[model samples]
Target: MKTPVVYVALQQFCEADAAPRQRLLEAGFEVRQNTLGRRLRREEVPTFLAQADAVIAGVEPYDAEVLAALSKLRCISRCGVGTDSIDVDAAQRRGIAVYTTPDEVTEPVAQLTVAMILALARNFPQHLAASRAGRWEKRTGVLLSEWTVGLIGFGRIGRAVARDLSPFGPRLLVTDPALSSGEAPDGVQRVELAALLAQADVVSLHASRPPHAGALLGRHELASMKPGSYLVNTARGHLVDDAALVEALQSGHLAGAAIDVFATEPYTGALSQMPQVLCTPHVATLTRASRAAMERRAAAHVVEWWTQASCLTPTS
Candidate 1:
């Protein structure tokens, strides 16, 4: 019998810690890590896994073709929560088990969302740019406590954000079909998405991204928002219509927006040119502690699935 091959498709996996690689090697499995030095593109996926039995994937796309081509591919151990990148249904059709560590990803992402929320509230980035450039400008900024903060999704990260914001005493509103009355936090009222959009002074997106699910915040949604209100997205890029968001900002219908992910990556799009929006290169889970925990757990998922044909239970 041949030692099964495990491919590490995530380019940055094991960079902070090598325990994941060690576990695979110790299991009598041959491990191959991505050497691309960057994000693994969809076209490059198949060749990279020419003979893989399992893979620890990042946010790489695994469409029908990618899954059908991999005859030996048995499982996908996702390093993070979101499966929007992987064609999970297609993988399932091919008998590929897809696993994720949603529980391990909550806190880090929540922290970044809070940080961006505060930044938008203050307008300090805009002020700092001017002060450094030899001009001093003073503008009145709103307090978090005074605004109606609406969360678009009530999952792990959204729940965590609602809890973290409690200290600031903002009026919390949430909208998610899955939200339960038993699980609703103190002062957090669950409302419909349209209601959340209409009433919120600061709207934050925490929704899951299902592939082909059209933009949650498109032109009509943006138009529905209270003029001059802020938008923050730590969620998937495709959740917002890029052109519509830009139009909202330009027309002053929205005060500003902050995003952590983009529809098109290595984002050189118009959103970057806007001073009102703060963007991060999908670094929500890039913390050292988060990386270590996710990597260890992600590797464990692959190992367990390889031997027992099941991965760890997902939180969300």
Candidate 2:
């Protein structure tokens, strides 16, 4: 009998923690990792996981075409929360179980979100740049306590951000159709998207990619935001239209933007060129503890699924 193969497609997995990989080895499964040192190209995914029974995935796309090509793949356990990269419906049709470590990612992402908000509010980046250039430049910055911070989504990460920001005494506004009135936390006002955009001094995106085709924040929505306000996005890249955001920043309509994700990664766009925009390489959930927890959970999901599938199989 051939041993089941589990492909670890996540670019960086269990580098510090060996428990997750050890668990798979102990489970009588042959575990293989992505050797390319980067996200596998779309064409490379099928070839790389050709014999995999399960995959511990990252932000790689697993569309219908790729799903159809993987004859033996039974599961795709995501090391992170978002499912935007995967064609979930297609995987379901092919009987591939998809899993994500939603709980594990909350703390790290929320922490980064708060950090970005504070940095933007106090003009930290500009100050740093000035000091490095051999010039003493001091600029007035706003206090978070005096600001109205709007959250675009009220899910786990959003709620966490609200909790962290509450102590700073900011008026919180959230817009999420999924949450009812009772679901809102104390002192957090649940408002419509338009109202949140207009009233917020700092608007942070925590929402998932909308089901429709267009960006959640287009030209009109960006225009509606309070002039000289800031934008912080630690969520999905496609949530904000890149060109529109660049234009807003260029026009001095928006004070600044701290972007952690982009429509296309390895992102070299207009946002990068602007001094007002602060960008990170989509690493909101990349802390040491966060990565370990997510990797362990993702690996556990694969082991659990494989064990269940093995027991259900009829033996000769």
Candidate 3:
């Protein structure tokens, strides 16, 4: 019998470490790594995925067309928590199992969020830039305790961020239509989006990116925010409208913004030119421990599904 082949379409940045590849080999998979040297285009993914028995996918699109092409694909082990990149309904329709490594990424992402909030609150980026330009600038910035933090979604990542922020003593307001007051983490008060928007001195987005066509923060939402309020997004970029955000930042309606993810990745646009805005390559989950944990869990899931084929159907 031929050994089952598992294809890994992880982004190029993810392949630099050898642990995931080695883990797959140790688990007896005939691992076929990236065919394209870079992030695969939409047209390129289905061609390679068609022959794969399983895949560890990145943010590349795996829509109905790609699903139809992957006749042998049993499972899609997502490297991160976000399933916005994958076509979940199409995968379900095709009887393919989908798993996201949410637990692995939660703490790291939460830590990064706290770091960004601190950096923004203290004006660290501006001071650093000024220092680099031979100017010793002493800029007074707002303290975290003086601000109200509005967490847009109270999911695992959001709750983790709230937990980390508890010691800081900022008032915490969370808005998530899916979550009831009882479901909120202790010390977090559930509020309407408008209420959160009006009161929060720093607003952070932590919502899931559903493929649905609507901006989570549009012109009206931005307008609702207090002038000089800060915005931070560790969530998917589309959650906030980039154009509208850029306009708000330019007009000084927003004091500053820190963003990790962008609507279109490898982002180069108007926001990139804004000095007040701090940007990080979508690397909130790139910590050594988190990366290893995610890969290990993803590899283990694939191995378990392959070994227990009779008990677990592709659909499950």
Q: In each prediction, how many residue pairs overlap at the backbone (N, C-alpha, C within less than 3 A)?
A: 0, 0, 0
Candidate 3 has a TM-score of 0.92
Residue by residue across 93-195, what tens digits does model 2's lDDT show?
9999999999999999999999999999889877877887888988899889989999999999999999999999999999999999788878999999999
Cα error, residue 88 of model 3, in Å, equals 1.5
lDDT of 2 at 73: 96
Q: Which residue pairs overlap in candidate 1's backbone?
A: none
Ranking by lDDT: 2, 1, 3
| Predictions in order: lDDT | 0.87, 0.91, 0.86
Best by lDDT: 2
Model 1: per-residue lDDT, tens digit, 156-198? 9999999999899899999998887677867999888888899
Better of 2 and 3 by lDDT: 2
lDDT comparison, 1 vs 3, better candidate? 1
List candidate 2 stretches off by more than 4 Å. Answer: 210-212
lDDT of 3 by residue, 72-164 (tens): 997898889999878899999988889889999999999999999999889977887788789988889887888899999999999999999
